[model samples]
Target: MTKQLPYSDAELAELIRNGDAEAFRSLFERFIRALVYFGVKLTGDQEESEDAASEAFQKLWQKREDMRGYPEMRAYLFSIVHNRSVNFVKRRSMVKAAHQTIQAEGETHSDSSITTRIIQAETMVAIHNAIDKLPLHHRDLLHKIYIEEQSTTDLAKMLGTTPAHIRTSKARALASLREILSDETLLRSCIVFFFLFSAK
Candidate 1:
């Protein structure tokens, strides 16, 4: 059996800073999957979560020395993950919200002749499609507040802003999404993806 390596976060940080590849590998093994799961939970997108977690780990490796004296290694790692996930979600929200708004408007008819069920179905699709296009910040806000059902106070605290600020940000983000997606029309059957390139 391979010898077990017992290391503290500070020691591991030192090892990484000293350019110990084995230490880095150990650290990656310990945290990568957990970070990815956390990212997915926060962002509600598996691929984006994976990308964020991977990118965050890459960044940590690049700046290993900075991890020293962090008091809480897990917290520090999760912080990076949170920031990256938030940014990704916001960007997506902006783009997707816009697209959804336009699509929904296009499908809505003035005549009350259309079945309510059909309208709801089409509107839901438009909503999801637009959400898919939103900017990372906006998308992140929506997911945290609405999808994840986080309390405004908790979100504000996590974001380092006040509850009022969070509310304002959400409003502005929504407005921005509406403005962008109000008119842009793509083929109804086609899907637009912003995830073509992963963040390195």
Candidate 2:
């Protein structure tokens, strides 16, 4: 039998545009690490780098049909990630400034409100840490659906799976996250925070 060759990046892009899950996975695996490294060098923050890289991949998926070739796809991914990292830095700066302003103002807020905000922030951090410990598929699913707010139907099409299966997998992933975030207090806070904020 003649040996078969791997698909070229351009070919993979075409396949991905046609909703080939394996091709998308191959492309994601091929470039995710390099993109993350690029983001880290630009942002100097590992968490932010991962977020930027994830967003870049999500953007690629969204615009798969628009990609003309491998070179354009590669350039687009890098550009998206770079912009995301820069925006993250700017958002962080804005948050810091707001925090400083709040401190300087010495505004007397209700203790309960402050406590709730602190708990929500801490719980969000814990949730992210737990997500980082999950398997790649589960982590990606959660981040894409929840963080990026991608539609389940779109993800199903991209992954070549049914929406029901995606929902089931997401349920399992959430169960695993709940297990990982087993602290009762934090879990309760996380649930409340998600319920309140997710409605918006």
Candidate 3:
């Protein structure tokens, strides 16, 4: 049997443009963590970071055909996240100022905050329900990876498998979760809420 080589980022982008789901998955796995970290640095909020990263991926997928190569794709993804992060920070600041003004005027602003918390809680519940619907192994793998932030090496040791196997498992788990959370807007919101708050 001939051994197949891994695709380069450029090759993956081209394949993604051609409507290859696996190619898109490869690109997602390659850059998601780095983009999230960059977003966190930019926004200083874990939830906002996840939101920015998710938005970046969504924008990339939407414009896949326009991407010329790996460098351009990478730049575009980072740029999207950067803009989203900045915008989120600005909005947060405005909200904070509004809250302070309401408080100064002896207005009851707790209702708005309570509503926000309730929405977040509901999103978290939905995310957990979706995750719970996954196969047992996949659910466990996702929890360990995203919630516990376990290294593949550590997971491999615990599961009596190779690191490569753990990586493959993670990819599959992610696909399953994506399928279950098919509503893009809900998925984005739930993902951010779950990763930022539920994980802890």
* RMSD after Cα superposition, model 1: 22.1
Candidate 1 regions exceeding 4 Å error are 1-7, 70-73, 99-200
Tens digit per residue, CA lDDT, model 1, 57-88: 78777776666542455556666767776677
Tell me the lDDT of model 1 at 179.
63
- Identify the runs in model 2 with alpha carbons over 4 angstroms from their true place: 1-7, 98-200
lDDT of each: 0.62, 0.69, 0.69
Residue 99 Cα positional deviation in candidate 1, in Å, after optimal superposition: 8.5
lDDT for residue 186 in candidate 3, whole number 0-100: 47
User: What are the clashing pairs of model 2?
Assistant: none
Residue 153 error, candidate 1, Å: 49
Give each model's clash number: 28, 0, 0
lDDT preference between candidates 1 and 2, better one: 2
* Candidate order by decreasing TM-score: 3, 2, 1
Worst ten in a row by lDDT for model 3? 1-10
* TM-score of each candidate structure, all chains considered together: 0.43, 0.45, 0.47
